[model samples]
Target chain A: MTNANPHRLFRGGAAPAALPARGGIGLKPEHYQYILDTRPAIGFFEVHAENYMVAGGPFHHYLERIRADTPLSIHGVGLSIGGDGPLDEAHLDRLAVLLARYRPESFSEHLAWSSHGGAFFNDLLPAPYNAGTLARVCAHIDRVQERLGRSMLLENPATYVEFEASTMAETDFISEVVGRTGCGLLLDVNNLYVSCINHHRDARAYLRALPLAAVGEIHLAGHAREVDAAGAPMLIDSHDAPVAREVWDLYAYAISLTGPQPTLIERDNDIPEFPVLAAEARQAEIVMARHAKLEAAA
Target chain B: MSAAFARALLQPDAPCPAGLKTWNGSDPAKRFAVYRNNVVVSLVDALADSFPVVQALVGEEFFRALAAEFARANPPRSPVLAWYGDGFADFVENFPPAAGLPYLADVARLEWLRVEAWHAADAKPLPLAEMAARLADEAALPALRLALHPSLRLLRSAHPVVSLWAAHQAEDVSAALGATDFADAEAALVVRDGLDVDILRIEPGAAEFVESLLRGAALGEAAQTAAPFDLPATLGLLLRSGTIIEATPSGRIS
Candidate 1:
């Protein structure tokens, strides 16, 4: 009963499930009753699918009693799936009723384009990857993975401005939108340190040409320095303060090139307490237990 | 400028371009006025967090110059900036610099009914002793129908918009504006119940008995249209004022 269609469940190579490579935190409303009374070992909880696209009390009964103690991820910041306008059948029927009620192990959004002729510029903006906006962003990520019958994780956006007809390369338009719609990526390391400091380029060479085996999940937040109408300083990914130390050294070099995955620690605006975001999810679980003791000493 | 003339300078009947010399790389209108001033300061901070009590009754510099002129006459359509100010309390009732606050359009319709009861749509509260033993069984009270609390917000106003929204939550609003009443007349509900956004008020036959059980009537015709207010103290002030968080008798309607 779990086949949600990506051309018949991603034609049998499947993937997704993985996550719990430790470190998680971004469940706010000032930490829902201190994460249901301190059950914080910190390794799973994500929320922001438009802040529980609500329809009841106590925000989905305290997110279904913290989705019966952890392993949830629904991150979507509005599915304007790179809008030029078209894909919004009531925001994909309310994201297929929140992926048929939080069967969320993963689900994400943003490749930038906060709507146009149908209006919505609530920020994120930047899109022009060209071959006619990469076949209109792979026909809007294959009609949003054929109407949320699953497959999502898009992410990669933190641009300030770039488009003189950009001929593909934000890791080849996210490796051709995961080679035409298998869809999965979420990356975000403080949006690769605010798009490599607002486009001078090289957040470790865009984390060495990204596509880390189509990632699946990773985001570490906080940015803001502003200046740009030519006063210089630039930056801005603004998930509002705390997460910096060089974006925690580009999230411990993107968890040592995307190995131990499910990391979060985002702070949507000066929100502190839930033990200061579980001490920034215990500094991303001591950098994923020092990248699992350097991959168990090689 | 061409990336279709800087995305046709964010359209409104596009055209402008006799301007930039270098921009980021300098002049190209200094890199399109820094992505058009961070797209009008992140959509005027998402219509000032979708009207914080109309930016606390128009103050944050007159609601950031009326959210930068109602975001150039209504900009957002729905990249879900929390359902982008559902037509900003009818664009501040035809904003001519907020026509000297006619209770700023019922306090932007009680901040769009607390952003539609903070994005409503979850219910399952039936147990008030199983809705009072199915209202003492008149065959389970005409197969009951009640399911309120998708952040339940009802609101009604003629002016003292909940004491001008509790004198914009007084942490010292010029000493709670010299003892209130600039024009008292109100009705409200605004739910959420367990993460604060409460509100309550009601009473005028308890807003027509919770608008006849939010227009689907029957709790015996919403306690006979809340019999001139006091149907068991408006159903015990809507179940102790969390405006009835859950009630479903007719084979539990979803």
Candidate 2:
């Protein structure tokens, strides 16, 4: 198959027309008309790859219209990349089809596993960070990159539990995966904050441990606060509300380390009007701009 | 190990899989419970989205409970949540909690059909001019085979499921709630035209005619099989709704 855009190379050699290091919002069906009519000054639009897997429909109709004006990032939630069993060849084929059709500026999947034993749990579940699991994950990533003929980013997962069999920190596991597969990292700062708070780890230290050079994109979203059984604060990566103050702080810190990267504001549940999300994307843009200016001056 | 962990997470009462721990070095049971809650609740929400009328009729609390049970017993085998509830209507049919309401299963079936039609493949309907020309050739009209649109689905239920479904779509369903007669048998035809999935009630015999056509029966054979139904009106409905994709002489077109 021929690359639709000859000038754009997603994986090998030099890259052109990459997603600019600007802010974007996750595309929702509710805001399709608004985004098209108002033509908001955002960086790009991201959508779940699974949502557009249909043969033909309104989803594709709107996506075609929206993609004409703005860049798009395809974030997949159902690849089951970290599952123990073999990767689902059928799902990979579907993803390949979508990626080829859109030739999205960026494509990413989560680090967690969501399927096993032929059953797919809708939620991302935690996996042990051991030699065996690491090898399996790396192999999965290799297969995905080979099949798509493009390098993809893997985002760290927000977890509520840890496994006793884990032999490495989550950051180290991710860094090693990147090292072996040559895949980029799509760091979700909100997930880092939620995982750190839930696991009683230092968020700043965790950020410091990540391989910032491999960071190709960042995600900022909202989380819900709840109490654990021991009466400790637990943060749920529920993208239903606006970005939290603490997550914003972490995002700024991450921007300083990684310079400007393609950032996205994800609000999947209880979605407000388009403006509310636009405002959040604007905040991310402001942060990236400040870092850009500082780098230019230095 | 991943498979075992998945089994534990899906089953709420199952013990935490071996070799799991919390960050504080305590038992991972409580923390794992959170993951468990997320999996079950997310799947349940998926079901509720696909079957809104069933949830509305069953009430939120009861629906959540029912969905949770369904999730635990039959977690999705695929990641695509849109296709996750293929067996839900059957599950409800045998569920003891919902035994008091026999129509609940039919409602679920109708909702599932709507979901299927909404995502079904798109097809361009046969042009009216072409159809008219074909009809003018009376010699081959009876042997002409009609191909239905990919989104067409016919459902037959012993209860007034069509009324129940329509009532739930209304702004205020109080009158519909009172007018529904549970004993009446109903048939529904769901088709996706453009971006909309429309549900229309049809006579039982008309449903049979469409089903026969779907099974590759010729026009004359299908009409004969439908027997007492108004074949002309049924054919008109099919044409008007754009459900017929193609018409070809039986032997000429496979």
Candidate 3:
């Protein structure tokens, strides 16, 4: 029988697979063949939406082969959801094309702005948590959701500097965004740790304060440490090494609260062999399993 | 405020944007510097990745400097970084820092063309046999319009950029560069067929022929423009490379 609800068919019927609440690794071009050949057992695979914004090439070819076997997540780095300028309709259109082509299980973007005026800076810059900035961000998110016809997860930014103009707290800002836009949150535990350390906030408190019920996914990555002028350790979200021990602790804590969201280990720079990333993914799974056992006992 | 921050982050000498405050209420200059550093360094790295041979030719330090200057003057307009550096070749041509290396700009241009060819739209090649069958009728040949693959790119430079680029790819770059004759003008035909991007050095006239074909000229007309060139060899190369996407006859075929 034909389903009466076409939206349900579009959302679930066309989706290749659902993201299991376990762990996945960020799919890099370097490890495309390794993943295809081995087809490791993981929850899902995540890719930066911008990387696959092409007509056709090995990127799409390998992604098609991988998507057939595993669930996919399209994480956008260029949406600039928090930008002051209007969202690039052309960029949004390209992203829509990719989303339709892949029909990924989940889509996510950052709360930080990466583009200003007409220039895309390529790095996620911080935004003030004020009413003006909040209104602009909400409108942008609305445009994206309406255009893509899919709910997206907005990630928190790892800030090196906070704006004095921010009248609202970071957690409140994110909560308000979720409250208003109906979008989920991609809680990057590493970014939380980095921002807390850089800005002297309590990571544990920040995690507990966030709207945990809205978290659809989790991200874990490594960070580099450097000192500021006053010799305070400043954590940079480098994503070039293994997930830091502190960030892992926060991930475990977050999972204990949120109860095992889909986690992704992102290693963009200094990418190691496939086995290395797979092992990290396994560690995340182990943490989630421990939490699951605890929850069942309770 | 976001505009000010972007300007400061892009330009090293620009003052820190207003409204920045650190955790301890100290001046946020150092903290803001980190974001600035990340933006400039990452964009420079992107350029390096896009133009590895250019980086190899002009050492890491010089390339980083050049890229930083380019980033400040001309930041990317699109988020697709693969499409970034569209104006890098022009930037290099006028960059005073690269005044000594005149061929550097053309090398950069060749590299940019390679990048474009790599990301160009994919096309299905018309079978050579089918194309040959269609072209069998000599009377309709002049009216036939041949379409090249979207990825096909022809480059011409007064300097031997093709050889220089090839040299940088060799293991002993210094030796390869030393052996190359910089005075010889060169042309290159770049096309992505199957799974690889093939860059072949072609005769100047052959490049003109491909250019004409790309402009929707008939085979006979293109051949006339490419006179004194090896037509048979060029045709064989195009066919072997699988670059012809379609051939449409202007007149009805029997």
The candidate that wins on TM-score is 3
What are the chain B TM-scores of all models? 0.38, 0.94, 0.93
lDDT, candidate 3, A1-298, per-residue tens = 2222223212222112257887899999899888888889978999999988977767888999999979999999998888888899999999999999999999989999999889889999999999999888878877888899878888988889988799999998888777777778899999999999998999999999887888888999999998876888889999999999999999999998888788999999999998999999999999999998998899
- Looking at model 3, residue A144 earns an lDDT score of 89
Give the local distance difference test score of model 2: 0.87
Every candidate's lDDT:
0.71, 0.87, 0.87
Docking class of 1: incorrect
Q: Which candidate do you rate higher for DockQ, 1 or 3?
A: 3
Say which docking band candidate 2 falls in: medium
* Candidate 2: residue pairs that collide: none
Per-model TM values vs. the true structure: 0.35, 0.94, 0.94
lDDT of 1 by residue, B1-254 (tens): 23453355455355435433322564345444555666667777777876776786667898887776677667777655666677777778888888887888878888788777766764444457766765677676655766676677777777767766776677887666566676777788777655556666776667876777777775766767533677677676666655565556665455
lDDT of 1 by residue, A1-298 (tens): 1223345334322238555777788787668888788777777888877656656556677888887868888777666666565677787787779768878787787887666666665566666677766666667777777777777778898776666667677887776666666677888888877877766777888887876777877888888786656676667777878888997887788788776777888887778777777788778878878988999999
Q: What is the Cα-based lDDT of residue A151 in candidate 3?
A: 80
Of 1 and 3, the candidate ranking higher by lDDT: 3
DockQ of each candidate relative to the true complex: 0.16, 0.64, 0.72
